[model samples]
Target: LVDHKQTALPALIEQLDSEERDHPIRKLAFTLRAIGDQRAVPVLIRAFPKTLLPASSDYGIKIEDPELKRWIAKHDLGKGRSIFSYLRAFREVVGALQQLTGQNFGEMELFGVNLANTESQRHLQREQFHQIAQHWAHWWEANQESHGVDPAYAKARVLMAGKKQGQLLDKDMRETAAE
Candidate 1:
């Protein structure tokens, strides 16, 4: 897709904020990450909240522990409320941002439902998520001018392409034919 960035980039950026239930936000972010363009940062940030753990539940993960599953099945604390965080599409956006910017803004931890059973614990979790999101947003505001293709992301792309296809594709996906 990077080779077709002239068209692919804009289309992906345009839909990065899509709220359609079946839109592959995760795949879009992944392609943008592979493209390694700093231009996608803002759109990626915009899409971040849609992937967050909803306010209805303190826990951000699906219950996978057999014991926890049994307990949740018995309790009415709000089953199915914590599944979003477990999906980790948010992490893909974060990972893309990290790759594109070569920065770490931190991510929220997934916790068991019991940990957030109390109102205070839930509130704390919510605050932490907000703070992390804020950090990324603020960082972008302050550092967008410095944004560009991260060297590491670029280098890895080159090496991977070379090893896989014996064709060296640069960060822009140009220079492939010459190589």
Candidate 2:
């Protein structure tokens, strides 16, 4: 494990956009939280809803709540399984954002709607979270300067400023780690 905060932060940030299906997004979120950098707040907000469903599920499909509930109930994910496999990653992203910003956007209001036990309720909760992500984005835009976050990372409202598709991870960003 690399201990250099400079070397580690950008790599972790880049992983948030990893297209790899099983990319352990929750781990990345937790790692960012442990780093305790204000910089991670913006990126976390950017990724808040990227993994609301299992990787095996279609990332682009937009199923209505009623249909999603029927699908979840009919499939019978078995005794120990859940529809929340990857949704936990989204939760971790929320947790990291709150920790870094010292703000409570209301976890219950953001995620705890209806206990989410019913499949229909889970779908509704997922939609609520997507809306909450928007709230976080708006809040960050207004508060990033006060938190000492850079404008480049804040303005585009995404993970990295120059995030090249072919660029190597953590290659050039380390030099500015101390800043």
Summed backbone clashes in each candidate are 0, 0
Best by TM-score: 2
- State each model's CA lDDT, in order: 0.54, 0.57
List runs of model 2 lying over 4 Å from the truth: 19-23, 54-87, 110-127, 156-179
What TM-score would you give candidate 1 relative to the actual structure?
0.52
Error of 1 at 118 (Å): 11
lDDT by residue (1-179, candidate 2, tens digit) is 22476778877877775632334776677667667778778678757655454423213223357765455334221213334233356566766776788787775454433334577766665556555555666677678899887665674143232345544223222322222
Error of 2 at 156 (Å): 6.6
Which ten-residue region of model 1 has the weakest summed lDDT?
153-162
